[model samples]
Target chain A: MERVLDMTIQEVRELLRKKEISSVELTGFYLERIKKYDGSLLTYLRVTEEEALEMARDADRRIGQGEDGPLLGIPLGIKDIFCTKGIETTCASRILEGFVPPYDATVIKKLKDRSFVHLGRLNMDEFAMGSSTENSAFQTTKNPWDLSRIPGGSSGGSASAVAAGLCAAALGTDTGGSIRQPASLCGAVGMKPTYGRVSRYGLIAFASSLDQVGPLTRSVSDCAVVMNAIAGYDPMDSTSIPQPVPDYTELLGRDIKGMKIGIPREYFIEGMDEDVKRAVRESLAVFEHQGASLVDISLPHTEYAVATYYVICTAEASSNLARYDGVKYGLRIDGKDIIDMYKKTRSKGFGKEVKRRIILGTYVLSSGYYDAYYRKAGKVRTLMRRDFDEAFKACDIIVTAVSPTTAFKTGEKIDDPLTMYLSDIFTIPMNLAGLPAMSVPCGFDGSGLPIGLQIIGRPLDEGRIMQAGYVIERERAVKKIPDTLR
Target chain B: MKITKDVVEYVAHLGRLELEHDEVELYTTQLDRILDYVDALNKLDTEGIEPTSHAVPLDSVMREDEVRDSIGVDSSIRNAPERKETFFKVPPIIEVEE
Candidate 1:
């Protein structure tokens, strides 16, 4: 089991393929680990033990019939944000506590089609709102590196679980650095494709414009494997780009000689952790040695990302989350009238951070402030995208610190919404630009906390971005398995 | 303050949310700070720039309008808090004015 935990998903695939280890056994092994470790980790929202075993059983049966695929029989953790049929998807909010979807999310359906066993729904920030997992209505997921620290969120559970080997790899959503920031902090590989790259048919809408389903994986290769399965156009999602899905695994071991790696000056700013900056600075040689050129660039509108993002995301969230009025689903608090019921239910059902965003969102999109906040943010968003477009003209890929600092202590920034919002400073810009970016573990800080740098690619250039990340992952080869596991 | 307690109350009302007195007070301070912070966007010159709601330009796809399978009423209202047969049962929405 220890050896299996160390081995990549590719190796697990080989083992399952040769009938050396049945899917049931592998599923059980992961389940046992989850049982043993998750108590301390508090990563999973709920472990779908029976469902996983049944899926594994189905996979083993299919294997007997000579069926094979990339993710066949692999056990993975899923963020609760995605709607899974017959399974309750709360998105870490009290309001949707008992709401079970009648159908799987498009990405969920895609993964199900690939015969992947779900370990369970992992925890996330309520409505994927806050930066840390402390906002979860259920449990605060602790960083596996140090139990005192938070696993960076809102995909904190997914990254923490994957890092601790609770699941081989996990699915997470990145609206504003939910995937990459957590993945970076936890030393797991997380990839967020371009905005329209993945289908969001059944993903609980956060900021519809910014929300994207992505993978947090054990390795860069595993990230690619999962991406290959989940990336494609779905008719159900209008925003999903109707483009051919590339085989992401094709450039696993390929050389990236002469590749231009853009280092945006704006992302490497004051207030960034010195160790993080040093790690990124040191990686310059590593990239150069791997036959890549480091080019200095500037994203002028980078500073405005956090502000712009807050306005737009909140505005969209206000509109999206308005559905949870206690009428059609989840938790309900009865009141005198329908409006009163909505008021009562939402007030009680939502957490503090969720309410804060809802209020902020409503305020921005409200009659008087829409033009100044929402529309202004929208125009600035265009500027941010233009900055990326100009920079991409000279470079194939960009590298920047995934988080300004390492995983912060739980409740460290929870009280201060502005400070907590800054946790995603480095990552928010990429989301605004709608580019493919990945968090690959770079090095460790003095306290052995993992540091990561995002390898960003142009729009729909996930394959290229992944190839560069694969290179860095190989060069760094930092200790991925958390000490908690050891 | 960009957002006062009364402003928070009005916004919460518009959002159909019932905020406690403290919540309104707290949100007033926090939202003011956030709004003040976001006030930096006014510095940028976006005079002639079109607001791009989506980063990528999307062309509407021409597809045949066909009746396909839906989640159905049973599944749709299955999670409803109060369901009367297929329709979602709700509290009195239209108030009859005396």
Candidate 2:
């Protein structure tokens, strides 16, 4: 029965359908695991014990009434970034501490419609800023595989929660590799939907254009199942696409014969870990064995991705975060005057990284430097997008490493922001291009850390990446549960 | 490209953030390093390229000018740091004639 906590959402779905287990039992199992393991992992910022159990009881009643939704009663974790009605959503930052949203995020609404029980709000980088969870205003979420190492961020808690078996699956946001990078480091399957696929209405703003919601699950099929529930059009979100949502699970186990997989030369650059490169190359061969053709390709503008991403993201962040004045929601430090109030509140509320980014964003968007920095970066972003457009023309999917290296030790790169930023180099371009990408566990490094192979598809083409990922997932069906849990 | 103390101070002011003296010094050095790294963008020739605000080309997103129910004052003010009735309380903006 303890092994029930390790089952995927799909497996749990069948168990509920067969009446072998009630939703209450399954939810309680995960809640118990979270209670036992979460103290060391620091995966959950808040465990919605009452809400989750109450929802589970309702789910059990629905199951008894013959309800047949895939996510019915499945316990999952929500990233602190998304608004849950009456649930505190702090975006792992002090600025939003103790703030509970009055309304549910659109994603939360959709999942609730499917009767998915949320375990709690998972920890993340402060306002989804840094690469490692160390930037969290609360406790750092450690990697489930190696306790001393960091679980990647800003969705570190989501990945770690799933990997630690604390939740059946978890929801995360990826503005710049927040979902996939952490998924890779934690050895879970994570998929970032196309930018506008999932509505961001209740999501805490980080860089409006780049921010996207995704799922980190134990398997690709589970990712597809979660996507089916969360992905679609929404009138509430201005950026939500009107395209019809497909049954993401429909494309699973589809034949990949004659599919062209591109290996972007620029992504395989200098200083990338040899183990990561080797593991990714080996997975390409697995795809080739599945009758897919691998072609070497180029995204020449890849070098400019990080620089452009920083400038544009920070500029937008500055504008979006300006709404958090002294009078508004969350933290407020009163001062002698209004101006002083705003300054004091912000300076005291935001973490060091958040403040640094605000300063950088302000400088870039300021009167004197807007043209040289912001506009130029935006233009370079166009060039980077063009590189993807050209490369995608020759391939069905692009294969690359999610990050240059696996999980680094905690406090290793927290002080060096540049090196920390570079950790998401490979995953950043896909976000900038608004394409769907998935990170699937490929193999392990010498230190037994998991390496992730990134599968990138064109905009609105999550099906293709899932189809390709399904094959790799089948061939390399290695159990990656950390020894800590065992 | 050299981010000096004045530049850091001015940026912090524009960002509406108060920085202590040590923070200013620390930020100046850190920003200098990051800005120097980001200077790599200047190497590319983006002469005629149009800046892309969004990855996808979205037409003007306009909804019908119809009234809809909002969360209203109570729920909206639930998270306010300081609230009075239905309004969020804040420091006064006007300067009295002394």
Candidate 3:
């Protein structure tokens, strides 16, 4: 059982198939780890121990009957943003504290169909809003590497749990840098697929246009397995493209003998940490050594990304979050009248960051400022996407630092919203362009926090991104269980 | 160009959000700074460029107008914080002005 914790998803599948271990025993091992480590990590919002065992039992029975699924019998963590049927799915926000979904999110359903076992719901920034997990109204998730520092968010718990070996892998959402940043900071591999690759049918809307569900896992190949399960066209999400899904794993072990890698000039500018820059530059050098020549590319519209994302995402959030009126699902506070009720419920239920975004969104979309702020941001989004489209013509993929720095200490940037939003500059451009990007662990910073190499691919070209990421993971990544866990 | 308290209050009202007085003051300064940061977009000329509402181009998705199984009222109202006989209960929508 202890050895199983160190194995990748494929290794565990081999063990499970050869009758070497039952799903029940494997899940129990993970449960014990969670029981022991979660107290210090605070990674889980809720651990559905009984249901996990029951699911594992079901998987065992199916395996006994000769059923083989890609994620069969494997236990995984779920970020709270993905709704689980009859389970309390709080996007780490108080507003939805007691809300239980009537149906599973499409991604959740896909994983369930594959006989995957659910470990529990992981913590995140409220409504996937903050860069650090401190914004969760529940408890702040501690970094598995260094407990005092934050696990990057809003997928903080997912990354931390995977790094700590609490679960084989975890599902996370990336609206901005939520998935990749945390994965980078926690020494895990996280991908934010193309915007419409996965179905958004039951995902709680943040920035509807930008919100995407991806995987955070222990290995790059594991990321591919999860992506294969979840990435598909769903008519349920009208915005979902009709492109045929490719086997993401096929690109692994792929040779990039003559591939062109792009290094955007804007991403390497001032204010980036020396260690992070060094790791990224070294990663490009590795690609060059493998016969992948590096091109000096420019995504000149990079600077406007953070600002445009704020305008766009907040506006969409303000609109999507409007459904959280006191009368309907979620928390409701009584007031003298209906309008007063709405004000009280939202004001009290939402966290500070959520409230701030709602107001900013409202102000931007307000009558007089509509053309100046919201509309202008929209046009700038076009320019940003065009910047990528042009850059992609020059190279197969783009590489950059996942975040300017590794994980900062808890409460470092919570109070200062401006400074906090700027740290997201590196990750926001991908969201705006609606391209697939991933963060594969490149190296550890001087302080031992993990550094991630951001790989950007053409729209719907997650295969190539994984190809490069697999190379980086194989050659450079130093993923290991932190000593704290040992 | 500054985001004044009144503007924040009005926008908050429109968003159906109520902020404490201190929150209003704090958001006023923060929102001002954020809006100021985004003010850089004003310098670029976007006269003919089209706005991208969705990154992937989308068209109206026409589906067959057919009845199908949907979540029943019982399940739909299961999460209502305040419910009255399958209806989400709320405070009175109409009240006489004081």
| DockQ, candidate 1, vs. native dimer | 0.87
Error of 1 at B15 (Å): 0.7
Q: Which stretches of candidate 2 lie over 4 Å from their true place?
A: none
How many clashes show up per model? 0, 0, 0
Model 1 lDDT per residue over A16-56, tens place? 89999999999999999989999999999899999999999
Instruction: Indicate the docking level reached by candidate 1.
Output: high
Model 3 agreement with the true structure over A114-182: per-residue lDDT tens digits: 999999999999999989989999999998889999999989999999999999999999989999999
Question: Model 2's DockQ?
Answer: 0.86
Between candidates 1 and 2, the one scoring higher on DockQ is 1
Please provide, for model 1 over B1-98, each residue's C-alpha lDDT reduced to its tens digit, 9 standing for 90 to 100. Answer: 76778888998998888988888888888889999999999999999999989877887877898898888889999999899978989988787899
| TM-scores for all predictions | 0.99, 0.99, 0.98
What's the residue-level lDDT of A478 in candidate 2? 55
